[model samples]
Target: MFFASDNSGPVHPRIMEALMEANQGHAMAYGADALMDEVRARIRDIFEAPEAAVYLVATGTAANALALATLAQPWQTVFCSPVAHIHEDECNAPEFYTGGAKLTLVGDTDRISAEALRAAIEAEETRGVHGPQRGPVSLTSVTERGTVYGLDELRAVTAVARDYGLPVHLDGARFANALAALDCSPAEMTWKAGIDAVSFGGTKNGCMGVEAVIFFDPAHAWEFELRRKRGAHLFSKHRYLSAQMAGYLRDGLWLDMARQANANCARLVAGLRAAGMEFLHDPQANMAFPILPLRTHRRLHEAGAAYHLWNGTLDGDDPDQPIAARLVCDWSISSDEIDCFLNLLRA
Candidate 1:
């Protein structure tokens, strides 16, 4: 019943074993290890991008910030949804890494529309040197609100960026989850959709802590390498990161984990519907945003269930009032756990 975050879940056993094996002998440091070569090649094959430049970091924030820094200049502003992870959750790391580049909120919703993005891009650079110039467009899949963009939607947004002669960056912090839900190839969701770079995330799926930043064109490879090192995100024992990703990608473990997570979310959604809860967003991938009665929330809390309250606290006067809850299901969440949670809600 611990739905606090996928971040709290345990690392997959295979990933842990891979880490143990990687620690047995000496290896090159700072991403020069042989394991890193396998990771690069594997990601390239997965994305059908042979020339893509792939680099690993310990956090999704570092991945997004460095990738954006490579695509956008300091004098420019990045366009993104108002609730994008890069905007709301990254703590301005993107601005810092881009050397003061600004973030322009494109739409009021968690998902940005093509029209909204075009208007936002046009709104920028209208003042010429007086205001921030238009930079790269960043789109988040499996958006903060738990909804995903279809392939057509992705193409539309990226097409809008292309019209403005802007590169597009995808903040795919839940890349595997989105891919599982969309049932599309990595290429279709990214480069094929006109994305210039992607923050290929792994941590929120099943890895311990590793995210890959992949540039489809490879033109900004050196710049990204320099920025990563300068940003202090370069890991000395880099093989550890490599081993985790290798184990994750091996035997399609990444997809399997994502499938299980998405299935768990669907199960939870069904249970929530049975309990007569209202969803704040469509349940997609591994996340669900639902509004439950305050009385139900209090029961769950008293039963030691852990999860995040998205909108309101439990101290309100009306016990029947509805408040939003963000429930995240990882690969490890069991049917029994979800059943227990559902049973509690029913009670």
Candidate 2:
């Protein structure tokens, strides 16, 4: 049972077929391909933003970093959760890409509350030109803890940023998963709720390493294009990225995959619950964090079950010590695989 990460899943057949088709003949280079035009138009229709600016990159880091670099200045600080991917997992790419713009972590948890966000933003710029000025409020839906931000929760935090006239960015690495959980349209979850830019992800859901950076306001397009090119994220042969995204959006395959992954996660959560697993956060999308006993963890590890242990090592003395672990379900994981995991847990 492979529950290590959605990023470890295989690409969907449709996405692979799209890539094969894209390899048929010669095409233009560096975003000039016809496939890219279709991908852009499709995203605009999906998001209901006719005037939005769309660009593609191979990794979520590139998408987030380049987009943020375009939105934020070097002398500012971005507000985000303490466990946000941009802050914890990105190896300071956002900082480097934004030209030394630092992150001011808001709440201590993965989810940032509006009250905490307001306090964080207010706490910045207190010293005259000494402290970093508040730049953008970056929120991660389907937070790192396997929890999703409700629509109201998203709006509350975005509204706080609005109060201070700061822009908002969504680190939507799990954007499709969040949409499946929330059952909301792209517009409702984003621009309508005051999000300025989003890194619309596809790699984790079904595609073969492709993410789109979308700016609801088209004015940021030129600056972003320059930043992407400067950051070495601009692909010389960009049609492959275009094909993966096009296939992902084709016939709403992206949503279908997301729904399946979310359903798989729900099943996994139910099975974990039946096994008396204590959860760190409610499973909302394709991720779950459960506290497993050290003995149980050792058993699962030896049995070839793959997952990340979030807390404590298996070498500890106590066999019954609770150790948290992260389990992720991708669109490709079968129900049988999930059952196998639960069976192992029960054993």
Global lDDT for candidate 1?
A: 0.93
Candidate 1 regions with alpha-carbon error over 4 angstroms: none
Tens-digit lDDT track of model 1 for 122-143: 8888997889998999989889
Give the backbone clash total of model 2.
0
TM-score of 1: 0.99
- State residue 279's C-alpha deviation in candidate 2, in Å: 0.4
Colliding pairs, model 2: none
Against the reference, the lDDT scores of all candidates come to 0.93, 0.93
Query: Weakest 10 consecutive residues, lDDT, candidate 1?
Result: 121-130
TM-score of each model, in listed order: 0.99, 0.99
Q: In model 2, which runs have C-alpha deviations exceeding 4 angstroms?
A: none
Model 1 residue 172 distance off true place after TM-score fit, in angstroms: 0.8
